[model samples]
Target: VQISKKKFVADELTEDGYSGAEVRVTPTRMEIIMLATRTRAALGEKGRRIPEWTPVAQKRFGFPEGSLCAIALRYKLLRGLAVQRPCYGVLQFIMESGAKGCQVVRAKSMKFVDGLMIHVGDLVNYYVDTAVPHVLLPQGVLGIKVKTMLPWDPTGRTGPKKPLPDHLSIVKPKDEILPTTPILGQKGGKPEPPTMPHPVPTA
Candidate 1:
């Protein structure tokens, strides 16, 4: 993952909307997952860039030739997730893409959240590819936090044992209700308002 980031950033491809990357390494092979907003620019014409990138990845990581596999995918934006209503499809997508486990949480409330609600733990801090992107809403701007379990390997070089954490700190922003002050004459209120003195007492 570090090698991939360096390569993309050096080539100035990050300006082309390169979000980030992930790596799955095993005794036999290494998998490079590249995510970008502009896939066409990042991949070049007909994905010729992948071949160009593969050699460097293998050399930098000291992996054998042909043992390095590169894949490019479009990074999902917060706006896109919001349009999905609940984002269960997102969880399913990641799980299908070799992820050991995955979870998506929108800070805003929804009738049907295919994943979790408010969570509390240090689970998200370990072995998770956590992303909290913001989106605009009628109420206010909110964040959609995604925690994907890193791909695991038997070589023990992979991330923590529990990649898919069970808890998150994301929660919906509560509306603020200002405390109203009661009328001075009313009970449980402030002291009565001061009265003006009689006509300045002979002017």
Candidate 2:
């Protein structure tokens, strides 16, 4: 269950059709998950505060007037959940539990009552080497839970428990629709015109 980084040499193709040797680094499962969780946190902070009339806000939310309150609210909700810490904790726990290899699946959706919910599942396989007999254990699943503590409710009490809606159910990333799809067009409808691509610079 030793976690360490490794690098390997790989062939990469350039635009000029020249094949060259490249160092393709493959991070461990723990590193990958930690990086991803941190990225999520960083993106979640974009809308933490209301925007003013600025080019940054216009480019980010597409509305310099701060009319996109929904995005800001969603960001606030996600920040409260503190996804990065919990996700990393889960991975560390799995490695400590004798898992040699692990894969994490992340699910993010806004259909929950709390505005945003992130679910993580770790699929792990391990083997025990002992003098008695070497035994390979079957794949196991570990789930991570993220809870928020409200200032008003110090005891961390939750409201009535209700089943998650179908839309909120955890599903594979491939099966989910892009978040920007709705902004582009109606459901199942033709997407809006594509934005012009930036021209590549020439030497």
Estimate candidate 1's RMSD in Å: 21.6
* Predicted structure 1: lDDT: 0.52
Task: Please provide, for model 2 over 1-203, each residue's C-alpha lDDT reduced to its tens digit, 9 standing for 90 to 100.
Answer: 11221111011112223323322222311211112223433233453222231234346333311122222222333445453543444344434533332222233331112222223322111111101111122333222222221111223232113322332555566676557633656776788787999999999
Task: Tell me each candidate's TM-score.
Answer: 0.34, 0.16
lDDT of each: 0.52, 0.29
lDDT of 2 at 82: 53
Candidate 2 at 38: error in angstroms?
A: 33
Candidate 1 off by > 4 Å: 1-82, 111-124, 137-139, 161-203
**Candidate 1 backbone overlaps, count:** 0
